[model samples]
Target: MRVTVSQPTRRGTRRSHGVRAPAPTVASMTRLLPVLATAAVLLAACTSDAETPASSGCDPALAAWADAGFSGAIAITAGGETVCEEGYGDANTALTVFAIGSVTKAFTAAAIYDLVDSGALVTSDRVGDLLPELRGPVRDATLMQLMTHTSGLNGSAGADHQPLWRADAIAAIGAMPLAFAPGTDHVYSNAAYTLLALVVEEVSDSTYREHAMTRILDGFASAGFWDGAPAAVGPRAVGHLDDGSTGEAGDFAGPHWALDGNGGLAMSMPDLAAWTHALFTGGVVSVESAAAIADPVVDLGDGAAETPGWVARDASAYGEPFLAAAGGGGDVGHDTMVVWIPSEERVVAVASNGGDVSAEELMAAVGPALAAGDPIPAPDAPGGTVDPDVAAAIVGDYRLDTGGAYRVSDDDGLRIAALGADAVEVLFPPRDAAAADAVRTHERAVADLLAGETPAGREELAALEDEFGPVGGAEPAGTIVADGELRTYATLATGDGPLLVWYALDDEGAVSAVEAGAQPPALDLVTDGDAFRPADPAGTGPDVTVSFAAGVLTVTGPDGAVTAQRD
Candidate 1:
């Protein structure tokens, strides 16, 4: 059904990429968008005790996090009953309540659907038809597209210089060019929803935050959803930064801004689990939109090269690449996961203030590990030195600086980059060495895509990757090299074998690229950083350094480095 979504404006609203400033003092230093699918071993091995419908079970996955050094809260529900509710690490650095990010989107979408049910609006109506100020291609986009991210608006363009707040948000998105013809592709734009919040304000005749509090957040309190915003930091588990520091600098620390429709909602794990149950069960949107909302609307399979091995690998393992799902956006300092299993009549919410644990793998492991009635295995972290042959496979020239002119290359085991920084820093993490010894971050590029928990396009990419192979790793014997603009790369096999291939493109807002063990000539490339039409895309190798400490795996690349505990 079509609905009209209007964009609104706020007076004294300072905007930057749709986030209002006085940015909530949230201390978590999160990464972004690492989603999981079913094919991953984390799923196959974790779901051994698959209970029948209506059966409930304590998620053994809870204990798994402690093994992985995760600190936060978790809740599991079956048949609309609270099956498990428990807290792990601190909710805030002060040790108070849990802070929920972008889950606010689900609430916002629900509120919009409520308006539709009340005959106030329809999801199929054109956004521009509602608010004239929401001019340009956005006006041409429908409310459903905006809700589903099929509209080309981006929550945050990769521009670091863009100011972040309400006023700046409106101006930036309003002025930005459409990434694609509206409804032609899905980009997962938070700014689009922020604008939808504007629509909420326009129709409800109230502020976006006010409308949400009244229609959604308040519903939780009325429904026995406790664990409200903490007045003082309580005994919650604490999420720490890599440096082990807390307060404003750490992952879980302080309050930033209030929850709006687009983001900024905070609550305990049980509360969110309850809220999600209500949502999927028709407490908010109609069952029709509810089902449609969860259904896959766009394909994001090509974005895997930018995903970390932990996340990209999981998506390939869990749900089918064709299954539709949503709601997995996460920040670096902030780590949270909620998986609603319709067939099982279950909803599992896993949260943590900590950084760099494989939530998907943990879930996959827990489902089977618990089902097998297997005693929680002694914590055996994932670790194994890569064969020099495998290590030699990924070693080559890779582009480190995204927008820089100079190039970087790696020899045997050492990496040097002209990144044109103050000095030519050697970018590699040390194995069994001091943390300060590494030059560049070990897990940057790999972690960048996995930083957030957005689950929208994971299944699709996981399927494609499964058909291909790992983004990096040796096949038989070969050398990898950048072909043209460093947007694509090739791996030439030593014997009479085909060349491995990969490429990336910026469509709408998300990045898309495909890779295969065998190279394809008609690959697409991004030139001038804007247009990624079609060119022989190529890339220099990203210098990779791997280190293991205390059973943890640390990897460094161009963007940054993250260590995953092998629990």
Candidate 2:
């Protein structure tokens, strides 16, 4: 999502006329020292001498570069201690922090899990049953599918509006339709999660912000959590754009558009680290729920070359590091990477306004530090392909290994399933012959629109749409798999990127699943692995095989004919 602070950004911008100034010395870096120390102790306890961190403060090889480029914040906490805390440039150009784009998903997940913990709701509950206002296929979607992103309400391709005005976002999503049946496949969808926030609001009988503040933010006051949705978060960090400029970090200018479940959270680096610590060490949710969240629910292993951690795609070099147990959020000039280092018994939280580039830098800087027990250099090299052109190039229809269809469309266009709500898009629309034709036509229209489109600040929106489909109302429970857990993969590519729920057993032995989108025809759900050679080379042809390893999936088609892996 493209988020701009109320204050003017750009090299020669100034503060807003009547905004309240940010607090001076909101929180001293020293406050984090104790936390860092505790974390160091914790880390030392968890690792052997070989894995122990270096005693010296590794040179700021990465930090120096970060200081030069973007006005940023850095916090390194291990175990329970805070090892490093610093803020460079301006945390608030006009009393606002950088918007942490999609990092907000972690918070949304936490809040939803709170409701689940309190018996207020369950992930498996159908969207239709709880959030009745939802019509179309979304009505049938389950919260689990939404959380795991397997809800097939919207196909892989749909309209996006993260960087636009809030009304535009709702309007665009409203115009689209679900592209596939719910629980049919995995498609990372911010729109789906944003709608989920609304669902949480309805179920809790309170605003999403209130729910998060009360149950999450407020509950963690001891850990430095603060209350801020539309308002400025205290001790926040500044975000920098690729234009070689920096600005105050905060949510978009639209008042109604606070950090939604899909993305839209603002916080300091220290606070985020604490939040991650709670998540990994059972401070946020119960161990059972945490385990469940981290557990792999389905496999997307067949007919795909490689598996990605978060988004389902074949290539990993271009995408963000997929954290099996962690979550990510970012838009335009804001980003956050929160990782739980279990081997070290610590949580590492890095929030930046440098957009997608931050993911790579954080990984580059911290990955080696954690692995080699050494310090990271400043201004770590940017990761992933951050070019707007590169991101846009991949924006098109992609056939998911799962049974449903997946596509990426321009930012403003809408997508709908056959016979689904004309105004309200769903994960999977009601498939009637008439509606399917219309949906196909809609795809063509969107392509035309994109071809004539200009850089009207919807690039982030386009990326979001490419990342997810339109907001489908309801669907079933689902999850994505990578390897067995959410660890980052460097050299190898294996397993399913995201597992889509395609079939279920019934009383009459009737195999029920969502209708396939525009994918190659397949007969059975079983698959061995991406390599059709079969796990057992001796196995005969017509072998529809499915194998679940570590937590990721790999499927080999019948006769070892076709193979696809979730990226």
Candidate 3:
């Protein structure tokens, strides 16, 4: 899928790219600001559990977070006992409420399953049965397809700039063509789940919030739909950007109700823990319904499977089987995750308001340690130098087969520039005046393509080469790959770090496919800022060695190395 620039909102909205904004007062904070002085004293006395040491089962996970300087709250349970409950960094209390983002889907999913258990609906029911207004192929989508994100709906249909009623949102969804045939493929769609929320309302004859409150949150905890107006909840944590920069208190804003069913849920760690406990223990739904909620009916192709609300996969730390669910939002500057090991009755929930670090990384670090029941050693820090000769071979201007060119320079470390109007518009979104105009021009071209004015979209894109000249700007910090194929990694000028540009060479050594923003997983390499180095100094990976031989420069890894011929 092509990557698109995402916009920010007052309420947390899920987006692929992080959105930077001046901090706004969150709903919870706004509601509690008047009572802050009094709440601080009462909260301090009530939060002693937040400092409790992890039981033997959770000690390693706690240690891992400590080692990584993680700023978050964590709660771990084993065999129905609390093994660890703690907070770190700015998230110094268990009562810190986090914008749980997509994790809200779990609650929404559970509500759907609850209705199923009550005989109000079934996974096999066609969505059209519930709402007759839905048009096109989407009407044929099963409840199961929506649960597993295979409903053929677009992941998102632009931004929800203002609050929208369920009917309005459904109408918008019905107007868009299906991205693909329903049930044929898995494409994550927040809109599909939002439709599920509408289904819940239609069957239960209750608002989505009312159904969720009574069925999912009532007995467990007081977490509710974030309506932008704070209810009487506990203290709220300030959200920080991914770079560890905190937004100002003045920036806390209200909820974006339009994101209902897909995201926009918030709660403290304890409440989150309670919610997890209820779902796994059949407290919220019957054992049979809970099982169905995590049945792994669809393969996600990444060694993971999708249940209604969770991703079933091998635990990264021990390769043990576990069900995991995660949610993150750049707009809210928060990430949250829950891991449930059914066999062991173990649950680990982590939530972070800081944007600089990902909850997934924190979970990955904690999972193995928790599973091992021992602290896993941290990977070695990155430090090494790329050979100048190897770097020189890959540094040059190469024209993209599609159109335009990119220049790689070794002048100040390695960097790449998106040259020409078309490439710049594709690689970078509208940020400044010239780039904004380019985007507008590109949008007009897209309108022409959509109108069938050109034989193909590619033709319109190629026509740009004649109409516009090159626009150049360099991204700092680049890595040259000399393994099997030549590739380079560099930070984009937009501040999103490390996009890989790959070059496929023909038999004559001419660059064949100049694909940009294609990155494979890192091989035994520890990344520190923009640089990479062998995770194990003594490891035998081919990437640990760089050599020049037979007119080729190679940066080798264990299985393979990227190589480029000397000019």
Which candidate number maximizes lDDT? 3
* Model 2 per-residue lDDT at 164: 45
lDDT of 3 by residue, 182-272 (tens): 8897656667877888899889968777888788777645476444533326666677752234542322342243567777677876677
Query: What does the lDDT read for residue 184 in candidate 1?
Result: 81
Ranking by lDDT: 3, 1, 2
lDDT of 1 at 372: 49
lDDT of 2 by residue, 446-556 (tens): 323223242211342243234334322223222111100110001111131222111111111111111111111111121222221111111111233333333233334
Please give the distance, in angstroms, between residue 284's alpha carbon in candidate 2 and its true position after superposition: 2.4
Candidate 2 C-alpha error for residue 560, in Å: 39
Model 3 ranges with Cα > 4 A deviation: 1-69, 157-161, 227-232, 243-257, 314-319, 366-374, 378-567
TM-score of each: 0.53, 0.50, 0.60
Q: Relative to the unseen true structure, what is the C-alpha lDDT of residue 88 in candidate 2, on a scale of 0 to 100?
A: 44
Candidate 1 local lDDT, 173-231, one digit each (tens):
57656767887865545666666776787788666666666666565642211123322
Model 1 spans > 4 angstroms off: 1-35, 38-64, 91-96, 157-168, 222-239, 242-259, 299-332, 355-361, 364-377, 381-567
